[model samples]
Structure formats: structure tokens, C-alpha cells
Target: MTQHADVVVVGGGQAGLAAGYHLRRQGLDFMILDADTAPGGAWQHMWESLHLFSPAEHSSLPGRLMPAQPGETYPDAGHVVDYLTDYEKRYGLPVQHGTRVGAVRRDAGGLLVEADTGIWLAKAVISATGTWSRPFLPAVPGRSVFTGRQLHTVNYCSPADFAGQRVVVVGGGNSGAQIAADLALDGNAHVTWVTQRPPRFLPDDIDGRALFDVAAARRRALDAGRTDTGGLASLGDIVAVPPVRAARDAGLLTAKPMFSRLTASGVRWDDGSRAGADAIVWCTGFRPALSHLAPLNLRGPRGHIPTDGTRALGEARLHLLGYGDWTGPASATLIGVGRPARDAAREIAQLS
Candidate 1:
């Protein structure tokens, strides 16, 4: 049986919820299809010690502000999960859980969303599936032959599992910094943190709120046809969240230059230095989770579907939300998703 809606949203995460909130306000008939069996989206899968870079007040979706957690200035992953769970219910967003979309193709009526549960045809489709499930591990030479246990950010949960092991964490981003700090603070693993270059840390006082503001400023500049004002990239890479700061201040989170290759026992550097390891955690980051849109044949050489704002250039009826800045400035973050989501909803309403 074909399920028909005026619009179909492919995710129920922060981005999808933001889209649904605006869509509801616009009086558009839409349904959000979430692959996860429960709410919280990717937050539920984050490492046990992970915390948001901003306070709860600064990290929120549209219509509802995330309530501050008791005793936590920067809410943890579990708190985020609770917030998202409540956000959906409070707004009564129509979210169908456990519906994994396999592909999206053009249909006679509109776009066909083929999911495990059923099919949906809609005049407009919003693909908000963020990158959690598709962790990207760089193809370092001999990675396949390494004997040590290897895992990506998606597969990691707790630092306890790697206790007392020699662990090498690769990547310069937030995940790598956090995971390395988590393990080091646990005082169990001997951690070797490596990045392609020296890890850059944002000022200790800066957090997600500041980053979002910078992105917003850059977006405004671009819209006015002004010279490109640097966004988050102008600031450093890693945010100095409490734990990361503590670990770095204590000299436990020092990062080495990236190793050249993997060895049978561990990793080897270009300078002939080698370290043995019991496990390797690849915090290399993720690609946008857009495999379901493959049938559309719109992805370019960079694996991104070109877009004007959130609307796909190749498919006007489709909008790709919350992948990153290309979709909107900071659209991937909780607080940042609202504006782009609102714009997408407004555009979809006009099309309908």
C-alpha cells in the first residue's frame, strides 16, 4: 500500500523535528520517517561521557527550549536524548519510528520514498538523515591488516571497555578530542592521540554558542554578496569542553602528528617511530548519510547533491537539511537547525 502525504521527512532527529515543527505551523500535511526504533536520534549513540559544547539554553530546536539539566552546565548525551524525546511529544510531530528508507526516486505523482515499513509518495521530500551511522575511517595504508581491535565513533560507547589497553585515537575533531580525554581521565588506557596536524583548540571560554553565532554572521555576509567572512573554521577545531580542557591542561591530551601507516601490531610514523596498541579508535568523522537518495542520481563528484539553500539543485521538490553548512550555516547542530528547517518548510509550503 502506498502512503501519501503532502511532504515526507526522512529523519526524526533535531533537524527533522525542526522541519516538522515549521511544517506543522505552515499547516502542511507531512510525516517524519525515523530509522531509529526510539527517539533521541544519534545522541543516544554518543559516547557515555560526551557533553554538548553549549549550555542547554543555547542548544535547542525550534518552538521549545531544551530545559537545563540539574547540576550540568553543559548537558550530556543522555540529557540530550531526554530533551529530544520530550520535544517530539510536546509538539505532537508525526514520527514513524523504525522506518528505514532504502531509496528515493522520482514517481509519477511525486518522489517515491521506499522504506522498510512501506512506500510513500510526496510532493516534497526532506532528507534530514545526519551522519551518525556512516562513520568515515580514512584509508591509512595497512589498516586492514592491523591486529589491534579497531572501532569508529559509531561503534564506541564507553571508555571502560578499553581500560588498561594501549589505545591510539586518530582524528583532530571533537570526537577524537573527547574520546582521548575520556580515556585519559579514566586513568586506565595509555592513549596516543594523533592528528594530521597539531590539534587546534578553541579558546577555553568559547563553545557551541559562539560557533553558531560566527556561522550565522558568515551566512549573513554571504547572503548580502559580501566577501566571505570566515565561519567556524576561523576559530580553532576542538571546543574546550570541561573534560577536554581538564585533560589538556594536565598534559594528558597531547596530540602527535598522524602516523604514516598501520602495522601488524600497531601504527608506524613516517619518521620511523612506532607504537604498539591493543586497540585503535578512529574518530575520523562521518560522511552525510544520503545513500537512500542514490536513485535520484543527483550527487556530484564530492558525493553531495548541489543545493541552493536547502533545496536541491537537481530536484526542486527535494530539500536536504542538516548535513552541514552547505545546507545552512550550522544546520547540523541542535540550535542551528531551526532557521534552515523553517526556510525549507516555508519553501515546501509554497511549492504545495
Candidate 2:
């Protein structure tokens, strides 16, 4: 059925759930559009050995606490899925699962959202796909020649899947290090971490919660033009962490040339060292996945739709969350998504 809502939230992750609740509280009629079959977008596809850097209770949405089982070390991907599923049920958030928004257009009438299913209209649109939307694999020489079973980190689930195989993990990011460590511990595989950039490991928290990168608070300070005044380090600075030292010492990591393209045999590095790895896991990163948005006249560098306040675009209405520092934490987090959702809901309510 073709329907119109006061708001149409894209990417039904924690951000979308939080927005659904806030808008409902304001009595705005809206529907959340998600690519996932259900809620818990990325977590559902996360590495099987994955656990949150923080405790489960700490990562819960605003209204509810993520109930942890006895002796749980933070929440694993499974635990988070349970929590998010429960959140959906508790609030009765309207969701269109398996519906992917293809492109977004704006006009005087309102916002036009095109999805794989059909078209949707709303007073405002929120993009909670987060910065990590697309998996990025660096291009190098002879990429096609690599005759190894290679996969992006997005498809990774469990260490057991790569059991007894020689796996080479590329990239120096948190995901790469964590997965390599887990594969070694669980899969009984020969895991090698090859990255051009060195990585730093975060210290375990007071209660020994493994610290992953939480850059929300730091972004707020940077957005306010205060990065030099002790704000969070930019992307360039995250590499300088001391954890890189710790990871190297643990024999879980190695320094190698930038990934050249695949070769028929295995993989080659920029510096010319090669490994005949059985499997290659790319933990690189992502780009905007809006290949469907072919003609959305958005105003941002690259594919980014930058925003200032809840501004209007060409012909569309938009209250962009995770685009700027509208409220709460400004980083790409639930903390970041929550505040903007509140603002967007309020703006949409007024427009309606």
C-alpha cells in the first residue's frame, strides 16, 4: 500500500528505533525503513566472536537497560540482537523490514524516498546508516591474481568458520585486530594481521571492559571547533595509540606493504612481500552505499549530505541525524543518533 508518514527513518538500527520512539511520543505518524529483515542492522551481520567494547548495560538505548545474563562479559552480538528485538516489541515501533530506501529527493511539497519496494513520502528523513555503511577494500596491483577465498569483514561471523585455515587479515583497525585475535584463539588457524598503518589498543576499562573506539564525545568537541583544545583526535590521530604496541607484542599483528590487488596465487603487498594465505579478511572500512541515489541533489562533498540544523534541501524536507552535532553525542553512535532524532521528531511535529 502506498502510504505517507510524517517521518520516514532510514536504516533501522538502534538509531532508527530511538527515532521511532521519540516521534511516536510526539504523536507523529511515521514508519522506519530498514534494509535488514528486522532491527539490529549491523550487529546481525557482525563477527560471531564479537562483543561490545563497553558493557551490555552501558550500550542500551535510552529508555531501557540491556538485561545481561549472569557472568556475561558485556553483550555479544547475540545478546544485542535480543535487546534490540525486545526494544522493538516494547515500544511497538512501526517498521518496514527488508525495505531499502534507494534514493531521496526533496521539494516544496515534501521529501520523496524511493525504496526497492516503492515510494514513501514524509516531512523529514533521517539517515542512520552510520559512517560505516559500505565495506572498503583498498585497490592494489594484481588483485585478480590472488586465488584465495577473500571476503570483506562485513560477511565475517565466527572464527570457527575459518577453522584450521591460514587466514590473513588486512587493515589495522579495531575490527581487524579483534577478529585476528579471536580467530587465533578459536579457529586454531594461522592468522596474520597485515596492515600498512600501525594500530593502538585501548586499555581495558575499570572493570576490564575491552575498550573499543568510542569517538562520540570527542567529535562534539571537534564540531565545536575545539579539537586542539583537547578534543578527540581526527582520523589521522587514531593511529598513534599505544595499543598498536601491545598488539604487536602479543604476536597477533604484523606490518606489511599496502594491499596490492589480488594475484592468482595469493596476495602481494606494496613493499613486495607476498603470502599464500588461504583466506583474506578485509577490515578496511566503507564508503556511502547510496548507489541508488543517482539524482538526489544533495549538498555535501562526495556522497555526503551535510546539514546545518534541520534545514531544507532542494525540494525535500530533512532533519538529518548523524550528519551533524544536533544533539547529545555527535559521533556515529546511538548517543549521536538519539539527540538528532529528538530534534527531527520535534521539527516534523511542527511541520505536520
Candidate 3:
């Protein structure tokens, strides 16, 4: 049977749920298709020790605020998953789990979302597939021949997995720093941090909340045709959370320049020194999981589909949510995604 709806939200993560909240208020019949068997979306796949840098009040979806767990300043991955599970039940959001979408194509009836379970015929589609599944691993020479273990942040679970190993954590972003710290401090792994460039660490006072504010301010400035005047903190800057701070205090947060190439045992540095590593944890980041929209021929250079706000320039009926700031400012974060999701919902509602 082909399920029909006024709007189909792909990827029932925070962004999809946010979009769905508005759609429900506008009396629009919509369905959220989630790839994960559970409700937490990408958070479920995050490393076990992962915790939001911001407080629970700062990280939330559209209608409901993420309730802070007692005695915890920042919620852990499990807390987030629990919240997401409750959020779905609270709103009774129509989410069909385990229905991974294979492709979305145009049809005479409407946009057809072909899934592993069934097909969704919807007038409008909001792609909220956040970038958890598509972890980016940078290409380095001799990568294919590297005999040591290699893993990306997506598959990373815990420091215990790499216990008593020489682990090289790659990338300069928060994930890289956090994971490296975890391994060296807790996993008892001898860890080396690698970066393309020196990483910036924000003041202890600044967290994800402050970062979002800065990004939002930048967006407002750009929209008003003015220069974005912000000091210090940027997206790439690492937050000095407890673990990171402890690591820094212990002199374990130092980073080395990127290696020249991979070796069978480990990596070759630019200085012609080879360091043997038992595993390489690539915390580089993720690419948008937009494979379902490939049939639309909307992808531009760098695998990004250009958008005017959240609406895809190639197809207006198609709106992209939560991929990144390209679609909407801070659309990838819990608090940040609401703006684009609301806008997309309103746009879809107005269309009907």
C-alpha cells in the first residue's frame, strides 16, 4: 500500500520532529520516515561517552524543551535518546521506524518516497536526514595498504574498545579532541592528536549555546548586509568541557600537524618519521546523507544541493532540513534546526 500525506518528512531526527511539530499545528497530515529502528536518530550512534556541551535548556527541539537529567549539567547520549523517544510519544508524531528510504523520485501523483517497507506519496518532502551515517574519512596516500585498524566517529563506541592500544585521533574539531582525550585519559590508550591546522579552543564560559548565538548573529549580520563582527569563537573552535579541560590540564590535548601519508603499521609524518599506531580514529566529520534525493539531479558541486532558505532551488517542493547551515543557519544542531524546520513547515503549509 502506498501511504499518502500532504508532507513527508525524511529522517525523523530532531529536525524532522521539529518540522512535524509545526505541520501538526497547521493541521497538515504528515508522516516522518526514520531510518533508525529507534527514535534518537544520530545520537544513538554517537560514542558512549558523548555529552552535549550545552545545558539541557540550551539543547531542545521545537515545542518541547529537553528536560535536564538530575545532577547532570549536560545531557549524555542516553538522556537525549530518552528525550527523543518521549517527544515522539508526547506529540504522537506519526513516525514509521525501520523504514529506510531508498530513493525519492517524482511521479504524476506527487513525490514518491520508496522505502524498504513501503512507498510514501507526498505533496511535499522535507529531508531531515542528519549526517550520522556518512562519516567523512580523508584520503591519504597508502590508505589502502594501512594494515592497522581504522574507524570513523560514526562507528566509534567507547574508549574501552581501543584499550591498551596506540590510537591516532585525526581532525581538529571537537569530536577529534574529545575522542582523543577519552582514549588517552580513560581508555588507557597512548593517543596522538593530528590536525590539518592548529585548533582554536574557546573560553570555558563559551559552550554550544554561545557558539549557536555567534552563528545566529553572523547569519543576521549577513542577512542585513553587514560584516559579521564576532570575537574568537567559531564552529571549528573546541569547547572546554570537563573531559577536555581535564585532558588539557594533564597535557594530553596537544595536537600534531597532519601526517604526510599512511604506513602499513601507522602513519608517516612530514619530517619522515613513522609512528606505529594500533588504530586510527578519524573524527573528520560527515557529509550530508542526501542519497535518496539523488534521483532529483539536484546535487551541485561538493555533493551539496543549493538551496534558497530550506527550499531546494532545483525543486521548491523539496525542502532540506538539518543537513547543515547551507540549508539554514545552524540547522544541524538541536536548538538551531528549529528555525529552518519551522520555516519549511510554514512554507509547506502555505503551499496547501
Candidates 1 and 3, the one with greater lDDT: 1
Model 1: pairs clashing at backbone N, Cα or C within 3 Å: none
Per-residue lDDT tens digits of candidate 1, residues 79-184?
Answer: 9999999999999999999999999999989999999999999999999999998989888999989998999988888878997899999989999999999999
In model 1, where is the ten-residue run with the lowest total lDDT?
227-236
> Candidate 1's error at 248, in angstroms?
0.7
- Candidate of highest TM-score: 1
> Candidate 2 local accuracy as lDDT?
0.66
Global lDDT of each candidate? 0.94, 0.66, 0.89
> Tell me, what's the RMSD of every candidate?
0.9, 3.9, 1.5
Weakest lDDT window of 10 consecutive positions for candidate 2: 204-213
Candidate 2 positional error at 43, Å: 1.1
The TM-scores of all predictions, comma-separated, are 0.98, 0.84, 0.97
Model 3 clash pairs are: none
Name the best candidate (by lDDT).
1
Clashes of each: 0, 23, 0
